[model samples]
Target: MSDSTTSIKTFRYRLYPTRAQEAAMFETLRLTRTLYNAGLEQRREAYRKHGKTLSAYDQQKELTALKEACLEFSGVYSHVLQDVFDRLDKAYKAFFSRVKKGAKRAGFPRFKPATRWDSFKFKQCWNNAKNDWTACGKPVDDGRRISIPKIGNVKIKLHRPLEGKPKSLQIVLDVDQWYAVYTCEVPVQPLPTTGSSVGIDLGTTWFAVTSDGEFIENPRHLGRSLGKLRVQQRTVSRRKKGGNRRKKAVKQVAKTYRKVRRQRLDFQHKTARRLIHEHDLIAHENLQVGNMAQSNLARSILDAGWAGFLFQLAAKAESAGRRVIAVDPRYTSQRCHACGHTGKENRVNQASFRCVQCGHTANADHNAAKNILDRGTSTERGEPLGRAVPSGENGSGVSHAVA
Candidate 1:
């Protein structure tokens, strides 16, 4: 349901660099990691010894001297080294922000290790919007090969042709695989208006409940992959540390977990796309999923992927010209849609709801969803809300049945 507009869209493609190219990229990563650690050390030392804080600009100005002293740094691209300073600057800013917020664990910026530093960004790219080869990492015309600065061109599997003005680019290493991620300015793809509005109640059991009374089943991606994941974890932990066997085992575990993560992302993306297609306005509770995850059901709550789904929905909606409203979540499950009565007695069971004062009853989730929908659409402006199109409505209808 997104309105037509321009938005930044990211595209990911697999990279198949040859052995020599891959080695060059790995060495570049090592150099960047060492530079990052050295920068952090300078910052800490300056503050401790002289009560002086070093800025990214301050440290970056010394790169000329650094390159002369350590000639290996010259082998890396100039912009890449500059971007490392930007990363360090961002990390320090975040660390201070968390400290001011009184976070329990104010994650101070730490030095990077080879394993932790897996991606590097190219801040400078063409503003002209072409996806072809250039100075900063560029993809070729046939979309089969991409060039990395200071490294040779490598074979790329471009599943889809890149479109729009290229903004920024990154080379990321996931486990043993490589991917090229590109951000581009693209026009938003808005779907035909359906006039349907829905309020969704997200849950662990049903995955989602709609005001129209449709229930969606949760796929439980993580729970389903636990068996294989457990076996992989056991193999990794059993292997001797620092050995080739251990490294291989770790990669295996990472790939297995990555599969589960991809599945969850795919599921959420598809689900959000469906809602955006069917509705002009989507209403959902402004749930703090992070806070909710602290309970005993943390694993299940996290596996549900509510936060990711909502974020995706809102983004899609904005792009499509649809509206997504986050309503207050308080008492949505307890409040009765029939007579406005709200109390603990309203919830008869997990799947059933009963209004004690009005003697109105319905499926718990369905009733909650209706209340949520009402709150979202009800306003002083009295603007018309599009009735759900019959062609798109597929709810297994509900009826009153007081127990």
Candidate 2:
């Protein structure tokens, strides 16, 4: 089987650390950042003076020397610092390769400061004594604790019991919050085929309309919380700039925004799981959300969350071994699915569609979903399909198919 068919799962652990532990973690981050910058400097000097390309091993050797030099500043070198250099080397090589292939825009790699050290890594190996699992860094006796090599045991809330052998572990710090990410290789039992398919039409008002006649109302999380958000923003603005009160107010606003984001993500994941469980194949429009978000109706467009919904749907489908097909949206709303009649007169309003030629009336979004389903099925059967047309194009509505 292809690597894509192999089952890999990720579990996130929220770390609860004492004040001293948090300080130590931050110090480790600084040490790693210092090592990374020193490695980058060595590469630049080597390139300029001797025209030598520094490999990861070469940078790692230099990192050891730099760590010794900074012994008085920090303590003994940690494996995390070496891991950071390895990651930077990999990133540099990938960037250059992409540039050479015209896949990435040309740009020079810049140095990262200690304040920006986001994450560090560890590896996991099977342990026979426990006959269960252990994280690469450290194994906590109590299930709630995780051990890292240099960093001692840290408490974590494992929301779910982990399954399978751990392959890698990453300790990431984001917005002053710490998270432990575990990547594992697990055996996946095949899900019983649902033998059903669905085509979804995404919109600004409703999150989605399914060909099966289901409507998922848009949560509008951002819009719903806008009033409170504005109040918080005003509070922050009114505070004396650079003062502790202003800083506290800013953090409060950040927390609110973060809550909304987390809620939206959770909702999307649950919705995707339900759809994936019910459908053998799923079809959705390949919306150019980035471009759409630039339009006058950007706020409403973002509220719809077309991109986020599609991303969740695609990921769930992949993990379930189901197919997700992207069909050109085009005139899906205006085209009559029953008669294949296409015209501007069909879509009478946002909520209603009536085919002028065939006199077939249906809900605007539902008709669009039916058209999407037809297109998806046709494409799966190896039929020729039209491509997507630009939004403002005249009567010619093209549609494109993608896997």
Candidate 3:
């Protein structure tokens, strides 16, 4: 596909809506939830009785009938419900295809209501005229806005100028906060190619160590906020269940956790952007983040967000037209980067490493980073390398190092 046709990027903007707008959003969410659950029920019953799965086209056909049956509810075609049906049909089709290919576990789908639907709203398309977006349901004239269909004018933070044609827009709610996500079709502008390369080693103790001898210290956001979180948890635990005070306390705790997540994501995006911009070729170990999350140090491991970091890095590198290479991570830390000798005794402590054969000394993570860079460079040049061999000590498993 041409770059112009294939390139797309999503931008998220926070939303602040009036009380009336909030109510409308809640109604939209409620209708969508009902439609989704009903569709899910249809799929489940079909499988239970006839052992048949619905294809995307088939689900769409069924949904058309369902909508026709609900024509009396004028708002059923208000664009929001239509989008919900479209999404539900697409989801079932994808899920069944996965099951057929053994990519997912075989199971019937289930249905759930939208008790919390009042928390959000959505519309598929909208138009903008004179900085105001108009759609079917209601006309919004907020100066801070994005245009969408059927949903009319919606408010947005407008933090940055939009760069491309808006292809899709979604309004989402998290806790009591609202946000807008816009998927835009952007023209590809690949960065000028260069021969620069770098290797990275990710750790739980430190966020990341570069082959160039730079370390990104772990912020440990969760660890830092643990005391405050514990106090909130204690207060909630002491409240009577189902009481208004208990619910309020629960929301406060959830909001705190969400804040930590948001901060971590922001940090990852910045770090990934910096790395992709600095190097033409990047190399790092391909880590199994899921496996790491199950380890004894899972809390710290999750906090470092190795998987999220790699995901962001890879995505940004792709957009920038940079090469990201994953090489075997086995023995990268234990092996001597200078002498090509591998031994367990090389990593003498949490922060230090001393090669037994070459007697080269460096920080453990730094040494690992160098090895990762070497492996990536070799792989890019078509050199053969052995699979990662697990160190067996410190429960570290060797896997593909992703750049």
Q: Point to the candidate with the largest lDDT.
A: 1
Q: Given candidate 1, what's the lDDT at residue 260? A: 85
Task: Give the best candidate by TM-score.
Answer: 1
Worst ten in a row by lDDT for model 2: 394-403
Reference-based lDDT, each prediction: 0.81, 0.75, 0.71
| Cα lDDT of model 3 by residue, 1-403, tens digit | 2263346677777877767666666666776787777767776777899999754456555655665777533454445555655676666666677687665354444565543443223443335454433343222454366544434466767787665555556777777887777666566667887668999999977899999888888878888889999999999999999999999999999889888988899899998888888899899998866655766989998998888888888777766777898777878888777766566777889889997666889999998998899888888887776444534555333333233
Pitting candidate 1 against candidate 2, the one with the higher TM-score is 1
TM-scores for all candidates? 0.84, 0.79, 0.80
Q: Write the per-residue lDDT of candidate 1 for residues 115-192, one digit (tens) a residue.
A: 699988777667455544356657765667877787777788989988766767788998888988987767877778
- Give the Cα error of residue 42 in candidate 1, in Å: 3.6
Q: Write the per-residue lDDT of candidate 2 for residues 1-403, one digit (tens) a residue.
A: 2156556777888898778778877777776776677778888999999999888877666655665676733452345556776887877887797688665354566788644567877644456588655546445767878876556778989889876667778888866689988877666545689889899898876888999999998888898889999999999999999899998998888778878887788888888889899988888887868667778989888766778878877766666788889988877877777776676777888899987766889988988888788778777777876432323345443323333
Better of 1 and 3 by lDDT: 1
Candidate 2 whole-model C-alpha lDDT, 0 to 1: 0.75
The runs of at least 3 residues in candidate 3 whose Cα sits more than 4 Å from the true structure, single-residue gaps closed, are: 1-6, 71-143, 385-403
**Which one wins by lDDT: 1 or 2?**
1
What stretches of model 2 exceed 4 Å from their correct place?
1-5, 31-61, 72-79, 82-117, 123-138, 174-176, 296-298, 386-403
